[model samples]
Each structure stands twice: as structure tokens, then as C-alpha cells.
Target: MKANNKRDVNVSKFDTATKTIHVFVALCDNQYQGIVPVPKTIGNGQDPDNNLYWGCANGIRSYFKKSKEWKLLKTQKLDKIRMERLVFKHVSKNYYLVADAYDGQYIKKTTTDFLYSAAGLLKDTIKINKTTIGINGNAKMVAYIGHDGLMDFQLNENFSNADGKQRDAIILACISKKYFAPHLSQAKANPLLWTTGLMAPEAYTLHDALSSYIAGGTADQIRTKGAMAYTKFQKCSLKASKNLLVTGY
Candidate 1:
């Protein structure tokens, strides 16, 4: 269904009879305007244009597609929206991954409609006719990636509709655990993995985490793998690695 903000949010069905896991990923926007700030000083300041926010979602899409474990099922690209639905099947396990990508306009808006739209999509799409381990049952997992920490107040103000689904969430944004976790947990979106400080929200960490998850890694293990991936690929310092956080196992 489409939200009032004109951004499209679509979710694929999860068949309980098949025992498949359906993952719904909402990537808010592709712009870096508000996410990475322009430096007031020229010589010693970092280039705001060098930010990776513009390519975060696309990087994730590429990471999944390039992986041998995931197969790209379909793709949709429009002026304001882009989506990719993928699947992973190994032996007796199967997983469905859906990613809905938004344009930069939504993030520039003054309203929290983007977050509301994402939450609405999550609540609408993730269902359980039976029981499964990481979704609607006992071991559900959800993740929010991108630069939304600057809109923390709006996110907290508008993000409040819970359908009583227990989920383990990973928010890969700046200070995600500090700013977004409380409200998310309060709304029944339990936090399993998150960040405590500024983060680039790179795709490798998420890719590694999902890889570990698909390989039967626990939440903590997934976090560790993600941190290691970030350090290895992104060349992050030890201080940056310490920003990764976990809660409730």
C-alpha cells in the first residue's frame, strides 16, 4: 500500500505452509543533504559530498545480488521509488527479502510520514498464520538502515503503532541505539542489534550480518560478524567498532 507521503511501500506474502521467512526492508532515501553536513571550513574539513548516503540502499542491493546465496527475483525502479525482491534457498531453508527504496524527497520533508510509512509497511507485511523463529513468533528480526537520526524527534513522535509482534531489530544509523531503540522497543519493536554512535551504514556489515543469520548465527554472533566486516572492508578504527551494540541477546 502507498503512504500519504506518496512513497510506495510493498510487501510480499509469507506462506506459513512453506515455512519461509519474509524480510521487509525499508530504505528511506538516497540523498545525503541532511545526513552529511557541509563543512564550514574548507581545507581541514571533510567533504560533505563524499558521503555514502546517496548509495547506501543501492550498495545493499548490489551486495545481496552479488552474493551466491541470494538470487535476485525482481526489480522495480521509478521516479520516486525503487524496489528489489530477492530470495535465498539452501537445503531445507528458504527466505524472501524485499527492499523498498525511496527517493531523496521523502527524507527532505518536514513530516515523519516516511517513518510512519515504513512502520505501516512492516506492520502490514510481516504476518504469521503459523509460527516461525525470527518474525512474528519468538525470533523475529527487523532492521532500519540509513540516515534518520537527525529526524529523531519526528520519528519518536510518529512511530507508535504496534501489532504485538516480537522482533529483534538492528538499526544501522548514527546513534541508533541511543535515539531510536527506546521508542522502537516501546512500540514492541525490540532491539537486538544497534549502534551507539555515528555510523556510515555501509552495506558490507549488513550483508555479513544477514549472511551469518542465514548460516544459523545468533543475534550476538551476527552483530560481531557485522562489526568485523565493517572493520575489514570499511577500514574503520577500533573506536568505531566499539559503537556496535546489542540488547536482550
Candidate 2:
């Protein structure tokens, strides 16, 4: 795996004081993606303000911003591939969350970036309150949210673990346990939360799981929190949600 050309040598400087969570969200695309089509208005990937995964009522930005645990810090417009970025800080914990919304057309890049981050091959830094914080590969937890691009295309790049340090990963895609198994193992990441079958990849599940995670809950406990959230929002049975939202290999 290739590392970022301009690396931040001081990325680990604040590791003891703060932890980072980096999330890559591929905006929902009705035309470019292979999933069953959604309504035209919200499925437009280029328009992050209305995209299903980024801007909708249940989207990451909207939902996380409304949470009492996370305080929205900054919002920035990025380049073409990555449309927007949101930074949030935990109100009670020394944790920072950075989420990037990738253009719908660049789902492949989003998936690749998540895998690279999980492998600890792509490290980067961001400044908050004049303090440099590690992101990407330096994040303690890396997550991929949106359509399962692996179901549409294959990746040729090797995502082997670049650093021996183990990181936690959350994949909120349909049947991710099956499709992401090989690459995830190669990346040597612990699966904190993932799905087993086709399901909606919404923000509630991630938010709830993080709530438990921040409270020092075990993997199974965190998974239960996510499952309960999914059940509450999706109006599904607890058994079904539990089966869908799983943790571990």
C-alpha cells in the first residue's frame, strides 16, 4: 500500500489526549450506484445538501448534529470527489469525529479510502482550536457508510495492514460481513459493528453504537445499542435488528 505523499510526522503527538473517529460516507446515487433506486430528489449524489446519506432527515450530518452527545464544530466545502466535511466534538469525552461526504459518482474512491484508512496506510491531520489532531489512518476508529460499492465493482489495490496497531471499524452496508471479510481481515481491523443482510444504512445506528462505545461498553453491548436504535427508527422487531446488526469477525 502507498502512503500519502505529504505525511504528518506529528500526527501522534496528541494521541494520549484525544481519540479520533473518521467516517467516509458515499452519498446515495440513483443513477451511478447499483442499489435499488431511491427518489430522485434525495438520491442525487452531487447535491450533498439533499443526498440520502448526508443531508436527508436521517442523514449523518442532520442526525449527528441533533445529538446531545456531539456538538457540531465545523462544516467545510471540499473538492470534487469529496463534496463536504463535517467535524464534531464529543460533549463529554475527548473524542473528535470527522465525516466526509463523497460525491455519489465516487463511491469507489470512498470505499478505497476507508479500506486504506483501516489498513493504516493513509494518515492525515486536522486542526481544532489550534491543536493538530490525527485523522484517516491515525483515527482510532474508521468507518464506511453508504452503498456497498464492493457489490458493484472490485478493488485491485492491496489493503494489507501498514501498521501493527489494531483499529476498530464499522461498516454500515448491506451484507458487509460477507463482502468485506477478505479485505477487512487483510486490514487487520476489529469489526465493531456491521450488517449481515440487506438493510438501510442510516445514522441512527452509528450514533447509538457510538453512545455505547464512548461509555466503555463491550462490542456486544455496543451492537445491541445500534440494533435497538435501528428497531426504534425502522419499526422492526428486536430479533430481526439484532440479527442484522452484528459485531465481530
Candidate 3:
């Protein structure tokens, strides 16, 4: 068996539509330096951590900070990828979605290889925080109904187990009307303000849902309920100033 090195690593990674969160670290002379965050400024002042990207940034930082085998090289932000605006007549099928922020396209309808995208940009958005204790994301709803949380509805333990299967079921619940919004009090006012129809992608990848939002309306501007975000994208030119960019960023 190969021995695993726990202390350090050096690698390039993509973290945004404009660039990857690429960082290199090593243990050359046995000294330590703090980890580097991304350049949220993109083209301006000192880089901000907001752009290091979430989810994958944590462990990657921890790995190099402790390892004695890796060292920092260079972190480069790529030209933004521009993807083709994807429109779903009715979400007839699932397809791959890619980012193209810098290239000018911003989005590509990978499903066209098959067919379809979003039908709405309405913002009844729900984000599941799985990092919470047993059954994060209020996913227990699946088990509460008396199912196994997976293959069976009665297996309640699975929902509280953090088992991969349980997580999948919980995510599926978010997209369904079954996961009704509890009366979350006023404190949860809204950080993703002005952004509509923003659903967490789960294992699907955020790139899949970007265009839906990049094309939708703001919380304060939701003139139409049940209005589709994708169709809304068509209402405004890509050049139209979006008030939601402040929150989405």
C-alpha cells in the first residue's frame, strides 16, 4: 500500500466563473506561512476570501498548511468563461451545464445534446445546510413520514446518520413541494436578496444553476410570482444591470 502524506500538497483548482482557486504549497525548508485566499477583487485591490470559493476551499487549505512536502507556486484567475444562455421550454430532460463567464457566452446548454433547462426563476429558494448535526437540512421530513430515508420510508435512522444515501434523499426533497417552508421568522430576512429561484445544486454542481439566477429577478423586484427565472433572462439583455449581483457575489 502507498503511504498517505497528511501534511502538504500543491495543485491548481477552478473556483469561479472567472478563474480557478489555484494555490501551491510545500515544505521546502520546514517553515510555515499562512494559507492564501482568492482574489475576489478579480482585477483590483488585495484578494478577498469570498472568492477562494466555498465547500472545497477548507480542506485544501488545511492539507498544505500542515504538510511538509508541498510549497506555494502561483495562483492565477482565468479569463471569465461565457456560457450560452440556456432556456428550458419545460425542463423536458436533464443535461450538463457549463460555465463561460470570460469567454462572453457565460453559459452553454449541454442538455441541447439532449434537451432543456429551467422553466422558472421564482425565488422560493431553499438551501440545505448538511453540515449541521444529525439530519442537517431538515431532511428528517423524509423519515418523519415513516420511510427509511432511503429505500424505505420507515428507516428514520438513515436521515440522522449523515449516511450518503440519507443526504441524497434530503436534497431531492428541496426540489419538491413536499419540503414546505416552515415559518422561518424575521431574523432570516434574506442575504440572497434580489436573487430569485436560487436552488442549491446539491451534488449537481453550482454551474448547473447559475444561468437561472444570472437571468432572474431580485427579491425586491419580484413583480410576478411563479415567474420563471430562465424566461425572465430573456426579458432583459445580458447587458442589463442586475441588482442581484451584489448578493450573488
Candidate 4:
């Protein structure tokens, strides 16, 4: 896949003493092509105003903005890259948050290509020589929120730098646990938090999971909290909540 010259990216440091780096990647809006078909209730509903398209991404951003625990460090819009990068630091904690938003159109068979590419770019940017964040080791967490199962992509090789880094992952997408856990585990990303059957990419669910992680919740707690949040807000059947799963926790 060819790289788009137009991309928006930003980074900031909250604390140099912190040993963990959190990465969040929210893919392009739902209007992008190659979006997997979701249930009408969560996808193309009778009311267009209330849909799951980009709901997870928007929700996660809103949570950070409203929370006192997180302080905005920097915000940059790189119009040339078609991506927006937001960095935050946890108040009274040694954790830095890096969130990336891709605004370009999603290309089929190349979405993951861009996803890993963006991650690689961020990793390179945070290396000791590149930034003053004092990042001397690998990241502690890397979370991805966006469409999944629409296409297949390799994860093992893309994140080789994180091998044995004990970096946990929280993926908010349909059947993420089923489809992504194995590859992420093989790549040495431990204790993945994901879901099993079909699921609506709702913001509340992602918020809960992320909240749990911020609170130092274990992988099981993240999955449980996220499932419960989905059940409470989406009003879906209990079976939907049962679909949340954890591995390598």
C-alpha cells in the first residue's frame, strides 16, 4: 500500500517517570468504504442521528475530555497526513496517552496496512532519540477502536517491536477476540481484551473498557466492564454481553 502524503499526527509527554505508554487508534469515520455490515439497530437505523458509525472513537475522545484524570497535553492537525493526533497525560500518574484519528477514506485490503503503519510511525516518533518523553522501553498498552472482520490482515509482524513488552491490547470491534487475539498473542502482546460474536462499536462500551484500564483493571475486568457497559447502554440481550472475552490475562 502506498502512503498518503497527507496525514495529521501529534505527540506529547505527560511524565518521564512513567514506564507505560498507551496508544489508541481510531480509524476513519464510518462513512469510509469497506465498513462491515452491522445490525440495523446499530448500523443504518431508522434514525440516522443515532448510529454506531464512529461512535466508539467519538465516545472515547469525549471521555478523556470530560475526565479530570486526564489533562490535554497537545493537539495537532496534520492536514497533509489526513490524520489528527491527540496526546494526554494522566494527572498524578505516570502514563501518557496518544490517540490518532485517520480522516482519509478507508481503502479495502489496505486499512490494516495504514493502521499498523500509523502505529509504526508513532513508535518511531517516541523512541529515545526522537522524543523527550524518556521512553526507554516498550509500551504497556495499545488499544484499537474501529471496524474489524471486513478484511484480513497480519498482526504478528507489524508489532514486532513490542515483543515481550507485556503490552496489553483492547480491541473494540466485532469478534475481535476471535480474530485478533491469536495474532496479537503470537506477536507477544499479552492479555488481550476483545469480544466474540457480532457487536456494535458503541462508545459507551469502549469508554468502560478504557476506564477500567486507566484504573489499573486487569484484562478480565476490562472485558467485564466493557460488556456490562454495552448491556446497560445499548439495551441489547444478555447474550451480547456474554460475547465479551479475555485472553492471556
Candidate whose TM-score is highest: 2
> TM-scores for all candidates?
0.66, 0.97, 0.17, 0.67
| lDDT-based ranking | 2, 4, 1, 3
Report the lDDT tens digits of candidate 1 across residue range 1-249: 323323222233334443333333334333333444423321111121222332333355656667676666555553333333334333335665544444434442312332333244332343323422222221245556666545543443655543444555666777766666556645565555678777667667777777777678886788788888878876876446756545452
Alpha-carbon local distance difference test for all models: 0.49, 0.91, 0.19, 0.52
lDDT of candidate 2 over 106-218, digit per residue (tens)? 99999999999999888888888876778888888999999999998999899899879788999999999999989999999999999999989999999999999988999
The candidate 4 region of ten consecutive residues with least summed lDDT is: 1-10
Query: Which of candidates 2 and 3 is the stronger one according to TM-score?
Result: 2
Candidate 4 residue-wise lDDT at 78: 42
The total number of steric clashes, by the backbone 3 Å criterion, in model 3 comes to 42
lDDT for 92 (candidate 1): 35
Q: Using lDDT, give the best candidate's number.
A: 2
RMSD of each predicted structure? 7.3, 1.4, 21.1, 6.6
Cα misplacement distance, residue 235 of candidate 2 (Å)? 0.6
lDDT of 4: 0.52
Candidate 3 per-residue C-alpha lDDT over 99-198 given as tens digits, one digit per residue, 9 for 90 to 100: 1111101111111110010100100111112211111121111101000112212111111121122111111111122221111111121222122222
lDDT of 1: 0.49
